[model samples]
Target: MPNHPQPLRSDYKYLQPITTRWHDNDLYGHVNNVTYYSYFDSAVNTYLIEQGGLDIHDGNVVGFVVSSACDYFASIAFPDRIEIGLRVGKLGNSSVQYELAVFKDGVEEACAAGRFVHVFVDRASNRPVSIPEPLRSALARLQA
Candidate 1:
């Protein structure tokens, strides 16, 4: 196995608690690897909609996922309360890269670490556009 760098809770600027659902576990009794991506998505979009003034329904500017990657360090199972740590690894005019980690409740070390990159685009034209000021400013606070 390739050696993956472990991330710590202190690396993130925001924390979102998540409850593991019974369905999240697979036949192996651990959260399915695919579910980690959902956790990453939920954490990032929740912050954007709640704190960054993102208008998902009627906004002219929208963000599309351009890239994503994850590395798992440990397995997590149902009934485990998990906390997702989020921070901005890179912020650009039209693109932002969010770094995320999954930590089992009360753990200081991450169980998984990942990154999601979003490119701001015009909803009508589907072309890249500068990130709006409100969103940009909100993202700035998350810079790591």
Candidate 2:
């Protein structure tokens, strides 16, 4: 595998604060690896809902995650205040690739970085659909 350097907070376009929960820690005492993915999902979806006007419950279109990945440079534990930084790496007709980084509060560098790909699809039919204009415009602001 190639060595990927951790990113700095300034590398991202948006930031969302997330509080680590007691349940997020594993027996090893660090935040479980799986939880990082949840953070990624939460940050992305929150942006879509708040800025893109995504109506999760009744919208005609919904985003389905098609791929995801993460790389950790350091451990995070419960009680840590985390800030997830988000940016758009690629935006397509029906899919968007979001690049994310997790920074421990007050830290300048990210402890973890990742990417998520979401494809917009028809809510009922599950067929891929073009990204709506409003959402596309909002996502464009995140481009880095």
Candidate 3:
């Protein structure tokens, strides 16, 4: 593995707790690799909805994830309580690059770290649009 920077809990601005379900584990007795992405997605959307006032159902603008990548450092299994740390690494006219890390609750070192990029777009037209003010303001607080 390349020497990617391993993220610590303190590196993130927002932390969201998530409970691991039994189904999250695969035949290997650990959380499947794909499940980590779901956690990342949930954490980001939760922040956008609760803090950024993103209206996923009826809003004129919606964010569509354009890119994502993850690096795993350790294993996690079902019944483990986890927290996902989130921060904005880059903010653009119509897109935001969110940096996130998954940690076993209360642990400092991240088990997995990832980046997710969302491009805000018109729901009907499906064309990119400038991020709305409310969402931008919310994202500002998460800058790292």
> Candidate 1: how large is its RMSD?
0.9
- Residues 53-123, candidate 3, lDDT per residue (tens digit)? 99999999999989999998989998999999999999999999999999998899999999989999999
TM-score of each: 0.97, 0.98, 0.98
Better of 1 and 3 by TM-score: 3
Flag regions of model 2 displaced more than 4 Å: none
Among all windows of 10 consecutive residues in model 3, the one with the lowest summed lDDT is 1-10
Note the Cα lDDT for every prediction shown. Answer: 0.94, 0.95, 0.94
User: Candidate 1: minimum summed lDDT over ten consecutive residues — where?
Assistant: 1-10
- Report the error of model 2 at residue 9, Å: 0.2
Clashing pairs in 3: none
**Clashing pairs for predicted structure model 2, backbone only:** none
At residue 39, give the lDDT of candidate 1.
95
> Could you give candidate 2's per-residue lDDT for residues 1-144 as a string of tens digits?
327888999998899999999999999999999999999999999999999999999999999999999998999999999999999999999999999999999999999999989999999999999999989999999999
Q: How would you order the candidates by TM-score, starting with the best?
A: 3, 2, 1
